[model samples]
Target chain A: MFQPSMQNIYRYFIISLLITVAVNFSAAQNKTAGSDKSSEVKWWNGFLVKMDVVSPVVTGFSDSEHFGMEGSVQFNLKRKIFPVYEIGFGGADKLSSNAIRFNTNGVFQRIGVDFGLLKQSNDKELINNMLTGGVRLGWSNFSYDLTNLSLSDDYWGGSQTLNFEGRSTTKTWYEIVVGIQVQVYKNLYMGWNIRNRHFFKEDTSGNIVPWYIPGYGKSGSSNTGFNYTIGYHF
Target chain B: MKRESGNNDYFNFKNLFNILKNFLHNNFIKSTVFIWITAVFFFSTSCIVSDEVCRKEKNSRLKVGFYTAILNSSTGNYTLSTLSIDSLTVNGVDSLGNIMDSVLYNNSKNLSSIKLPLNKFSNESKFIIRFNDSIQDTLTVFHTNYDQYLSFECGIIRNHLIDTVLITNHFVDSVKIQEHNVSTIDAEHLQIFHN
Candidate 1:
């Protein structure tokens, strides 16, 4: 006799749910685009506040060792340019595969400007959508504790363990961003962006490198980040 | 009435198909695709994490030069010159006063220079050196070992500073410390004089 397994049933259920949501979302988007009307211009309408919901959600869903949150405020100029300030808090308690452990929490901030690239048309002047390319300068200051770093000699018969506590450092970096924003409601927007981050200064003189940075993902030669944001217009 | 409804449905399908085609050709979609492709290419090409291996054998060993007191006819005195030791054997001594056999050389015939590794964890290294002259000398090296962290891949290496060297006068008449800092860099650290 043929039978469906529990895992198969769950997978089928999720697939059907995703299809239904996609269809409904497309229909809502068409209706909103057809009915949206232009509002009277005001100076305060250019200001916005946004929260990066994806970063917090991703950090929450991750396994033990990491947590993060980020938010930003931006000003639109001439509907062609945007100036933004973003702030975030992050922490990690990780034991590396080699048994080296590190624990830290810190704050990071970034200031940036975004340029709109969407072509303007008289017919779609009422639509509030943007395709943006931007650049950011980021900074973070943090203290960390590294423990259980073991050292052993191959030829000589001896071993030692080392620990460093409250080591403090400051870092500066820059990021190039590419993203899009769409007006999902009268005064609400949903957007997503991808950023390429490069470090301006990193300390490698010590034997250990910082495994994770606050705003940055993994501390490496370079890093990449993705953010999904929800915003409200004033 | 049914035929007319069928034709209307076909016209709506053709209009939807044209809309999809126009959306595919939109500038925003094209730009997004370009950026994503560039990002993927850059990520795949640059995201390489490599573990560095320790290459230089520095500070790991101590070098000693063998010198003989040869008579110089021009100066009318014995001067130091290179001497080759034959049938040399070196052994280490344990903390309990037991001889740990062949810590450096095992009845090997050394020509001129030999590199000997110091004990990493211990502050003292004791060696019994024997030569073909049927003479045995006890050489004791007093040192302090400092922990040094290399990279993650290389782990920890110990650096040594020689406090003092004590040697029994047998075949070796005297000892001189030329360099006290012991590291992996190959340089003569001591001079053993044979008369």
Candidate 2:
């Protein structure tokens, strides 16, 4: 009887230890969950810096080269999606008009979100993994200074000097970015994004014709591009 | 005797090959280092920094200059300096400098603008033209024959800040017409009377 009682007591002690660990883990998860609901920029433990090669396929410029680069910074709102701000720079437009060169080299700044859609299997016996997916919508305000740009009768064969300054305008655009970021290697993530831009409206305007956009060159409609990025979090 | 001599000859050839191999190996290593050094020197010298002045030709003329301000946004009324004149030239700016479309200034030529050097210029010191009515005007500026472009200097004095503008009136001309809309204000409108 003494031996049986002792065995039963030992089993109870082991079960109680297990319950304590489970409760502690659950409390920790709840604490993290509470924090995630507070801010759009605070879902993650740290931030991510991403670089992507961009190809803008604005409609008409299909046969031409419209390669570009985007640099973005994201702050997490939940385990997956985070608000992001991006700036882009690249070579000039591949197509130049009689007066405008496709020299599209400039800086583009953007603000949006990176949506994380895939959840990784937790290595720890206690943690359960979750997956999330979302989209980013924001406005893009960007423009190039035409003062440094020269418009010539040069393309169509005219030597007449063009006259226009202070004649330039500041243009605005809007974008919808959709991305899938997944957990891969210990806090190291990989994501792919495709963004669409609807660019129109000018703050000031004059005589010169606006340059064509990549993917939708001069179609003056919507434009789209894709990005592949690798990031690590702290 | 012939077979043994042939074998001896083969050994000699192998020795020669080994010597040449060692020589080639050392030479290639040296050559690679030399090429790398040459590349470093050539690439380092490629970029050269030089300086050029960015000032345009009109900056020298102190020409085609004027200071006007908006006093009443609702009325679209403005005021010009007492010595408001038209048409200056500079090798510095647009072919057609500043020109008013319909407003009237008594003297269009022999342009003698009042050279009032401003002592100070601040957001508060608004030297404005208080027009009695709304007028659409463009300040026509040009450089004088000896001038290139204009410069405006503003300074703060003891109590009054002054502004000075340099303009050249050698090449351009100014004509002010008071009517922005001919249907509302006709050509007879003028600013000929100022005390």
Candidate 3:
């Protein structure tokens, strides 16, 4: 019989389940405070709240094999340039080799700018429509748990091979996310974003070939797996 | 009574050892085949159950009756498996590098439609499929079988980049038989969890 690792699988299942429940509950509870904006402020100066859910096209082992949550709030400092803070989770599916499930995923918190496309109108004929684009740079702690993965060769292929059935943690991960949003209603809007996550630094052949870092169209490029969420302005 | 019981235990151990030896020598691939059969059977079972959704007979081997690319262009129609000392054609290699000849392949078929056979494999063993060095040495494909799944693992090893693997099935059209990176995975990590 094969060596069964049922215990570890069960533990992983529980962890994933808990995270799913927590995120869903958090979104529901913050609906009022983060859903729609009240009509108390002027068009030029207002706060916008946004929340989104992400389901990946490629996942499992290579990435966190589950749908994750991410949301943010931005209090418009001005009409042209608005500074905002955001936080969320991300996972990678592409790999350089099969030996390692080259996964780099974690939570991120960033502060960036949101540029509005159209000028705020004084007329109320249409519910205020606007176009927005933004970029954010944040820090993330990437952790790879190898406890459930194993690599063996022969009868003597012992634990010296750095089997993945062990868990590992790697912090100091940085990612950049840029996206565009279109506001159709007063505060309700539709938006899409692409996030790029790199290992921050690469250490290959002692020359540091950017193993921990990623480039354009290079490794760890999150193409188009973002979500569409409804936002309300306050 | 104790002596008799000890003798019985001794014989039981001897019998188990003999059975194991036989399994290793004659049925060398017994474990491997069992795992492979189970994986094939499982995916086949799922397709069978999902018949009401999309009606199709339970195909033991996915028919590649129609293939688009025949000329790999770079590698002259033939390559060698560096790890296993076998000649692997463009389609896929087996335990021995002989171009996988299938019962479905028709000699009279044109090159355009000359589809390779199904990559029949099991979980009892893992296979490494090496490509001709002419194209690029950055890619390596792996085959690993399990009780309920047959995974094809592929990865690119770049000198100045982060490495990654894609573990999935042969059918590139559907999202069902998905693949993942297996390097960092151990025996403990495989699971089917709920949302």
Candidate 4:
């Protein structure tokens, strides 16, 4: 079993926090040098439509083992809090070294909120940039097929082949996400985020569990993922 | 005053835009993106190759240990201790009293314990044990077997629960069931005691 160490989690969080502080400090310096327009507080700001650009490249390199593509809509509120809804399709076709084959494909969803860590500034350029940290709850319900499973009785002189088709299961996990987004052009942004995902429950003994989860990467106690995204702010 | 300030703010915004455009064109951002993409590719590849392999034991067998009862002189009590047999031969037998072709132990010498495989298709297993090629005993074991799924790589294994054991008291004195459940775990399941 591959277990993510607590020390690594702590180190990731510390690095994210330091990056947030550094970006915030730089934004503050720029704000002091720019014009001082009266801060306008709007309860509802427009949302951004974002698409992940990294998944396809990864899938292509994975040699048909893993495939995933996802998009998200994030609503900006008072330029501080962001509520997000993400949806995606993911699948896996894996052949074990022992010749057992597993196949599955399904849709997954995630709902979360992000808090902007930088201080609000009136500069038009600075207002569009954000350093955020968030939490997400993700879920997927899917079915899988496993074949070429063979069991032999060496002493009894017999062998049996077993195939399990359409084994259904539901999985849920939580993520700690941290990212920085910067405006590249008018209403266009480019960003990258790192996620630390943890599963709520694991498959019990004697049950056939999935080798790969839809939104969650490989099925394990925990995993780490990275996403590069391009977005258009409306 | 408001109009002049508005014009000045517009000029500052244009200057900031130009600075950002130059920043994006710099080599730093370009290299960062390239490095990130490379890292992501390697990370995904590493995940794909790191598949779990089945390394656990898969064979299920019954372990029998030889023991003897000895009188403790000072305590005036009898204690059971391990016994090593001088010569032993064991073979499987059918219900019709015909010996099977497989020989579990072929005249083995100086063994304190021996492991034997039970029948997966039948409810009972019979074995003939010959001591020094002279004194012989027949041991019959009644067991119920079930399949247990271990993992994808390991597949399934048959586990047995011993219901009863019958042994003819020839060279063997008595038998006791130490552990009834038998799976891949290597442990003593039965103890055969001799005088």
Best by TM-score: 4
**How do the residues A82-188 of candidate 1 rate in per-residue lDDT, one tens digit apiece?**
89999999878877656778788899999999876443323453346776777899999988887788756554467778888888878889987767787778889
lDDT of 4 by residue, A1-234 (tens): 856655365466657556555555556567657855424668798999999987887899889798999999999998878999989999999888778888999999999998776556566756777657888999999998888877776655667777889998889999878776878999898888877788888778766778888999888777778888999999
TM value for model 2 = 0.34
In candidate 3, residue A82 scores what lDDT? 68
Candidate 4: the clashing residue pairs are none
Candidate number with the higher DockQ (2 or 4): 4
Best by lDDT: 4
Among all windows of 10 consecutive residues in model 4 chain A, the one with the lowest summed lDDT is A16-25
Q: A199 in model 2: Cα distance from truth in Å?
A: 3.1
* Residue A227 lDDT in candidate 1: 80
lDDT of 3 by residue, B1-195 (tens): 999999898677556654653453344235434534643443334324311121222122211111122345787673311122112223333445443333222223222212222222322211222222222111122344221111113211111111222333332211112223232222111111111
Q: Which one wins on DockQ?
A: 4
What value does DockQ give for candidate 1? 0.10
RMSD of 3: 28.7
Off-target runs (Cα >4 Å) in candidate 2 are A1-43, A55-67, A95-102, A114-168, A200-209, A212-219, B1-195
Interface CA RMSD, all predictions: 9.5, 25.2, 25.2, 6.2
Model 1: lDDT of residue A9: 44
DockQ of 2: 0.01
Residue runs of model 3 more than 4 Å from their true location after superposition = A1-44, A56-64, A90-106, A119-127, A147-161, A164-180, A183-187, A196-200, A203-225, B1-195
On a 0 to 100 scale, what is the lDDT of residue A49 in model 4? 96
lDDT of 3 by residue, A23-95 (tens): 4344435654775543344446787788863333222322443324567787775454567777766644333
